[model samples]
Target: MSNASTSPFPLAACAEMLWRDRPIEWRASRLKELGFGVGLWNWPEHDIGKLEATGASFTIMNGYLTGRLTDDEGADELIRTARETAQIGKRLGVQRLNLHGTGLGDRGLPVQPIQVVTGVMWLKARDTLSRIVELAEQEDVTFTLENLNLPVDHPGTPFGRAEDTLALVSSIDHPRLRLNLDLYHAQIGEGNLVELCRKSLPWIGEIQVADVPGRFEPGTGEVNWNGIARALKAMGYSGPIGMEAWASGDSEEALEAFRAAFTI
Candidate 1:
């Protein structure tokens, strides 16, 4: 296998979503051998010693074990767990730690669903993120808040929309805290991706992708990933772009399709 990137951007694939029959370390090692970084979900599910032995460059992983961004109790837990995860992330040389508006439960549903986000809730969420920024700065690590889709995958998740995440991230305007900017979720919750990326350019720590309607690799669904790739290149946004999707068939073929779509 060749270990060279065709795209200018640093490409990664979530190991949790690919090669389901293989061991996690095998998946990570394979991705690294194929010239891609690795992404993970919750770290506790895998063996840290084995992961370290694989020597994969971990791009991102879930930053918290359990917590929400909208309330006091949840915020406290979020901070504590994120702090602990930061240590593990540093040990693994992971680039960014990922977070959602709230902890996701079985089937990616919100553990604590919110029907309406009041003005007070918005203020609280921002304050919570500010504290997260403090933790990031102190730990010398970056944390990203990812946008989720309400209509399809994650319903009732506070700040799940790209607009909401942008508002919150831009309001904080800190380097340690940045946006994960999942285009798959943005496509489901809001359209106008190019424009959204333009608006999100300054605060993006990383970009995540999966084709819409199936959460599979780029060519398997109804997303113009090639066009988006061109647009991103034109905008001078060369950063990490991760494939957080499942394989429609063969995982290797799926990864090749993803690389092709982003290789402008």
Candidate 2:
């Protein structure tokens, strides 16, 4: 239930991935026992009460939008969904809400990337997020714009690069709106991890870490986590750094390696 003020590098275990052996309701408490102050989750839904009972901080949860923000109709839907979820998040002591800006146009069909007229898509996304930011401002919640790797993990996603997401956030300049710089996706979409993180530090609200290629724990792939940690510390980014990755071996062992790599 603490942030950077309590620790040099605030870290959290991803509840969605780690501790799959146990019931989801019990995962936060397990992370708390591991000396982490925060736990990451997606879509609060019915889990708010269960997570609140654990007495650990739910660092961040997905906004859970059913449609892309690439169109007016989808944007309206996202706004409605986010506003509803934000209400539950506030009651559950969740600190931040993560959002994947847009989605593939038409699921269950051939995955064609949004290649035509990128400007229109960007403008639509901007307008869509503007409304979400208003909701976040009203609810006193923080919204994090997460960048995904298009044509890799996520095909046809609009905001696949860090620059595109940052541009959208900058255009809508608000205190509550910030970046969720996911290192794994960043590496896959674009390289130069430390530089990208350092440049985006000002707008960054939260961070997610995993090695590239396999998307496993740090040291398993080519990502230089030690250098990234130093960069974050040097830039004074003391926000919760989320371990969102697959376990290379035992989940606990993966987390232990995470602790050592991040020096938490």
Candidate 3:
């Protein structure tokens, strides 16, 4: 629902991640009660301004990475919506635009060489990212690419690893395209957390935190929160740490576990 933030402080999300039908204004007020604005994902158009009205800070912007961007027209629409969202985020003073780096079309493509030179199917991926960066720059909203692995990522999935996502940042070479590193996913996708964070450095915009097993709170699952926190400290990462994981029980229990594990 939220980001795996180092602060151990709960960030905002829709219906606190339950996905139940609720008003954005209501959600924003609830998020304020919890102390911060959430990365708004499944929100309506009218709520965009309303969520910002609640004084909750924006963390992530969705609407582009779902089953929607499977075709060319959808891709253009995705970019257009993304550009508009970036403008909204800028007006709302949100710092990051979190996005999924790949789509379904990314799944079936085969990697091959051209003219004795092996190259990735970077054309489609590269083009989308370029447009995202250009539009984000217009709004001054820096981008954050979250590492989504497991079953979804295929050979052609745009970016599944921290380095790959970071490489996109390098290839696009845009200051806006950032790595939204999720520690839990890293353990599954790429385990060298220290090195990944070290390599990404300034380009690493946001971080999500959670343990393995059930992907519950840090303590409930299996990540070394203390060590990870130390690594984050070593990297001099000062951005918001999101508690992005499943809850075992109620909100209180979830937050308590989150604090116990993350408040290093």
Top-lDDT candidate index: 1
Q: Each candidate's lDDT (Cα)?
A: 0.94, 0.76, 0.61
* Candidate 2 lDDT over residue span 1-264, tens digit each: 333434478788787677678876677787787776554544533466677788877788876546566778778777887888788788767888877755333431213355453678778888888888888878899988888886567766667688888888877878789998888988998888888887787788888889988888888999888778877888888877888888888987888788778763
Question: Total backbone clashes of model 2?
Answer: 0
Error of 1 at 117 (Å): 0.5
Looking at candidate 1, the ten consecutive residues that score lowest on lDDT are 1-10
Off by over 4 Å in 2: 1-7, 37-41, 44-46, 103-113
Question: What's each prediction's clash count?
Answer: 0, 0, 10
Best model number under TM-score: 1
Error of 3 at 71 (Å): 8.4
Q: How does residue 122 of candidate 2 score in lDDT?
A: 77
**Whose TM-score is higher: candidate 1's or candidate 3's?**
1
lDDT of 3 by residue, 1-264 (tens): 343443543344333453235666675666556555466553344556676677776676553444222235645866876766666667667667677644333332322212121133355566777877877766667877777655433343445567767777777777778788777778777777777778877777677766776666667765677677767776677676666666666654665565555455
Candidate numbers, best TM-score first, in rank order: 1, 2, 3
- Which portions of model 3 show Cα errors greater than 4 Å? 1-27, 63-75, 103-120, 152-156
Candidate 3, position 237, lDDT: 72
Looking at model 3, which ten-residue stretch has the lowest summed lDDT? 109-118
TM-score of 3: 0.76
State each model's C-alpha RMSD to the native. 1.0, 3.1, 5.5
